[model samples]
Target: MKEGPNIAAIAALIGDPARANMLQALMTGVALTASELAQEAGVTPQTSSFHLSRMADAGLVSLRKQGRHKYYSLADADVAALLEAMSGIAMRSGMTRVRTGPREPELRKARVCYNHLAGEYGVQAYDSLIAREFLVEEDEKLVLSSSGRSFFTDLGLVLPSNETKRRPLCKSCLDWSARRSHLAGITGTALLSFFFDQGWAKRVEGSRVIQFSKAGDSRFHEAFSLQN
Candidate 1:
């Protein structure tokens, strides 16, 4: 057999189906309890615990102990990126291209990226800004324009408290499924928060999927011109 990229280590870590599911859940960035994750993977708590323990030992996940509950999340942002990339490859390799039943449209819409927005809506938002010349994309990095500053200012999202406000505004990250660059970095996070503040989106309780209410839907459609 021909050899592949030097990812035997990562391949092994993700090779376990149960561990893979746990990693997918953590990709959403919320710390999930063992039980919640167990349900997600359709495994018993003990099975999930075993998988989580293995992942935690591998440094793929971080474990936190509260007063009682133990919460698990991706070890860091890099871990999330790694998982996303792995998912992208899996999709391209025809690992999960088939869905026998109806797919959940909301999932491919606005969803959490660790702590920010991602998915089709995400791609559209970033694209609209680029189309309008409010944000410039160059070499996968975004530098906000004068109009961008004014845009956010009028939207009521002040610049974050950075010692040097010269930080790059937005960064383009490759979306695993969409095969396009979506927004990331400080600008991306702030804009997501702005959407929430402006009532353009709301988080579904106990879940990371964001659903746009009527006002929010209209606002998002008007602001970014996203196709349903």
Candidate 2:
């Protein structure tokens, strides 16, 4: 493998089913402790920890220690982006959905794609912002305009202190099911947090499933002009 590119190395790192499941569960881009993650991947804590360590070594994830507990998450936005792209390939092969009972419309409607935002809900939000001229796209990345700062400020997010003109406002993430780009990046995370804080969405079972309440439904219609 050359220093510039190593597709085989990356593939080998994510090839294990357990590690793959762990990555999928953390696709929401939030930190989660090993126990919670164990449940998600259907593995024992010790086993999960072993996988976590391997992934952490591979630079696929990162861990933080807090008061005797360690929480794990994707190493960075780049890692999240990789998982989203991989999810797209999985879906293209007709592997994302399972016959595991009923349809999760709420989940399908809105949930975290990776670290940024995704799902039908994320797509709609991104589209609305674009319609309002808050952002523009070049190639695949989303560049924010000055208007974007004002728009986000109105929505109660202060721009990250780390942002630079060349860093970009958001990045396009592939939706596993929708097969389209959704907004993701520092900006997308902010919007998702705002939704939770505003009571527009509630996390279900501490998983990626988010249920929009009636108030949320109304608010989406009002704020974003979403009919559903």
Give per-residue CA lDDT, model 1, range 1-228, as digits (tens): 868765677678788777887777776778999999998888999999988888888778899999999999998766776776776777788888467233346766777777667888888888887887888856745778888778778767786534233334566766777877778777777878888888788877655578888988787768776433
Q: State TM-scores per candidate.
A: 0.82, 0.84
Q: Which residue pairs clash in candidate 2?
A: none
Model 1 lDDT-worst window of ten: 160-169
For candidate 2, write residues 71-113 as lDDT tens digits. 9988877887777777778879877546633536666677776
Best by TM-score: 2
lDDT of 2 at 116: 52
Candidate 1 regions with alpha-carbon error over 4 angstroms: 1-6, 97-103, 161-169, 205-208, 225-228
lDDT of each: 0.76, 0.76
**Backbone atom clashes (below 3 Å) for every candidate:** 0, 0
Question: What 10-residue stretch in candidate 2 is worst by lDDT?
Answer: 96-105
